[model samples]
Target: MARVRVLMAKPGLDGHDRGVKVVARALRDAGMEVVYTGLHQTPEEIVEAAIQEDVDIVGLSILSGAHMTLIPRVNELLKENGASDIVVIGGGTIPEEDVLALKEGGWAKEIFTPGTPLENIVEWINSHVKSKDN
Candidate 1:
């Protein structure tokens, strides 16, 4: 199987990085090459890194209740840079309504919340990204 590339980022002022680090490690252990951009990233920086890394997925880790603003900004930046094929997903404290709004705003995938198994994320990427490659 081809290795999937994922750029995981922490956008905004959320300095709490334990979750993002854990997820990044899990993704790497699952055989995907993971590039983690440390805390305090802007939407522009995240999108730029995703494009430069040529990743298959751009996963944002936001816990500051700013998913509404950040997710859409990243999505727009990706579209502007012609990196719309890069799947944009997230994991944060966002509400269900916000998740639906993000999907509607072109996030390609839904945000994973607390208690969501790492296996589920791994499986989702395996299925979705692999299919995209074909």
Candidate 2:
């Protein structure tokens, strides 16, 4: 099977990237193809890149308290572009209460908060995300 292709993005005004860089490295180390879209990316840019990359998953890192806006917009843009098959997930300073809505709304399949084990994230992706080539 082809390796899972994942697009890792930092959306909105968040400037800190150390955590996302670590996650991207971990995902890559896990044998997945990881593409990181640097910092201050808009939702549209992220969606376009994910679709263009043919990624199985779009993993967004948000820390600007704008999860409500960023995640949904990305998901919506993906759908509008006929790439809704690409799963969207996120991580960062998002609050616990919002997790349910993000998942229920189908905007994000998962959301990892600060302190979540890196191994757990890797395991979750291995189990949940299917490679597009499959």
Candidate 3:
């Protein structure tokens, strides 16, 4: 079986990236091919990377409290670019109420707040995401 390919991005002007880096490492360690887009990326850039990389999932990390705006933009751009099938998940300093909205609004497939176990993240992808070839 092929490994799942993930594009991890930090969108907007969020300068705090320690947590994202950690998640990237954890995902990599879990045997998924991880492509991290680094910090301060626009939703367009992120979607472009995800398409170019032929990734199965897009994992966005935002700490700028702009999840409501950024996450939806990324999802919209993905659909506009015809890559809406690429799963978009997020992790950040988002509030609980917004988490529900993001998911309910279809902005994010899943939103992981702080304190979410790395295993849970890996497992979510393992169960939910499949390599495109599969």
Candidate 4:
């Protein structure tokens, strides 16, 4: 089995990166190759990196309350670029309604709120990505 390729990005002016770094390290430790795009990335940059890297998943860590704007934009860009196979998920200070909106917009498969276990994330990616081949 091949290692999962994950692109972890922090979009917009949200300067908090500690959580994203932790998740990246955890993903790496779980045998996934993680591409961490540091702070202040635009939706275009994130989508371009995801395509160029050929990542299996794109993880957006947003704490700036712009989830409504950024996540959908990224989703649209990915779809337009023919990279819709890449699964997008997010975590951070997002309201439940916005999370639902994201899902409805096909922007995210899941949104992890605070206190979600890292192991759960790894398991989710493994199951979801593996099942895609079937």
Candidate 5:
């Protein structure tokens, strides 16, 4: 078995990154290989990084209420680039009503709103992301 690789990124103009950093560190502590793409990445840049890094998961943190816009773009790009197998998860300030739609729309595999435990994120990734090396 191989370690799960996760690419954690903050896309668009969301400059508040403390939460993402916390999650990144948590994921790292949990024995996963984590790549943190610092603030203000475009969707294309994020998708490119995910592909180039050969990550098993792309974890996006956004607080700008742009999930409906950005998540789909990232998802679309991943599909268009033949990388749709990359699991997409997100967090931060997302509305409860949008969660189901985001999941059903195939943009976000999971969306963690405010107050979600770090343990939950780690466990979800552990269960969902298969090691590509397998």
Candidate 6:
């Protein structure tokens, strides 16, 4: 099997990047190639990076309570660009109530809330992301 390539990005105006950075490190340590697009990335920017990097997954870290707006835009852009097969996962201060809708809406395949273990993130990616070469 090939190594999984993941693009981790922070969309919108959220400057809080500590959580995403930690997860980026964790994913890197787990043997995945991680490209972290730094603060204040728009949905289009994130999608472009995902395509440029040719990543298997696009992980968004949003804490500005704009996951609803940002995630779908990214997802829609991916579909529009014919990259919808790329898995989309997110982490940050998302509310419990919005988790189900986010997943069911096909925007975010998974949503990791605060206090979620890094190992869980690693495992989820390992289980879900099929390498592009496969």
Cα TM-score per model: 0.93, 0.98, 0.98, 0.94, 0.98, 0.98
What ordering of candidates by lDDT runs from best to worst? 3, 5, 6, 2, 4, 1
> Which pairs of residues clash in candidate 4, taking residues 3 or more apart in a chain or in different chains?
none
Off by over 4 Å in 3: none
Candidate 6, residues 1-134, lDDT tens digits: the string is: 78999999999996999999999999999999999999999999999999999999999999999989999999999999999999999889999878988998888999999999999999999888889987
C-alpha lDDT of residue 62 in model 2: 91
Global lDDT of model 3: 0.94
lDDT of 5 by residue, 1-134 (tens): 89999999999896989899999999999999999999999999999999999999999999998888998999999999999999999898888878888998888999998888999999999988898998
Clashing pairs in 2: none
- Clashing residue pair totals per candidate (backbone < 3 A): 0, 0, 0, 0, 0, 0
Q: What clash pairs does model 6 have?
A: none
lDDT of 1 by residue, 1-134 (tens): 56889999999997979888888999999989999989899999999899888899988998999888888899989999998889888997878888888878666487898889899888888877852444
Root-mean-square deviation of every model: 1.6, 0.7, 0.6, 1.8, 0.6, 0.7
Q: What's the true lDDT of residue 28 in model 4?
A: 93
Candidate lDDT values, in order: 0.87, 0.93, 0.94, 0.90, 0.94, 0.93
Error of 2 at 41 (Å): 0.6
Task: Tell me the spans in candidate 5 whose CA falls farther than 4 Å from its real position.
Answer: none
User: What RMSD value applies to candidate 6?
Assistant: 0.7
Q: How far out, in Å, is residue 52 in model 5?
A: 0.3
Considering lDDT, which of the candidate structures 3 and 4 is the better prediction for this target? 3
Highest lDDT scorer: 3
Over 4 Å off in model 6, which ranges?
none
For candidate 2, give the lDDT of residue 40.
95
Task: Give me candidate 1's TM-score against the actual structure.
Answer: 0.93
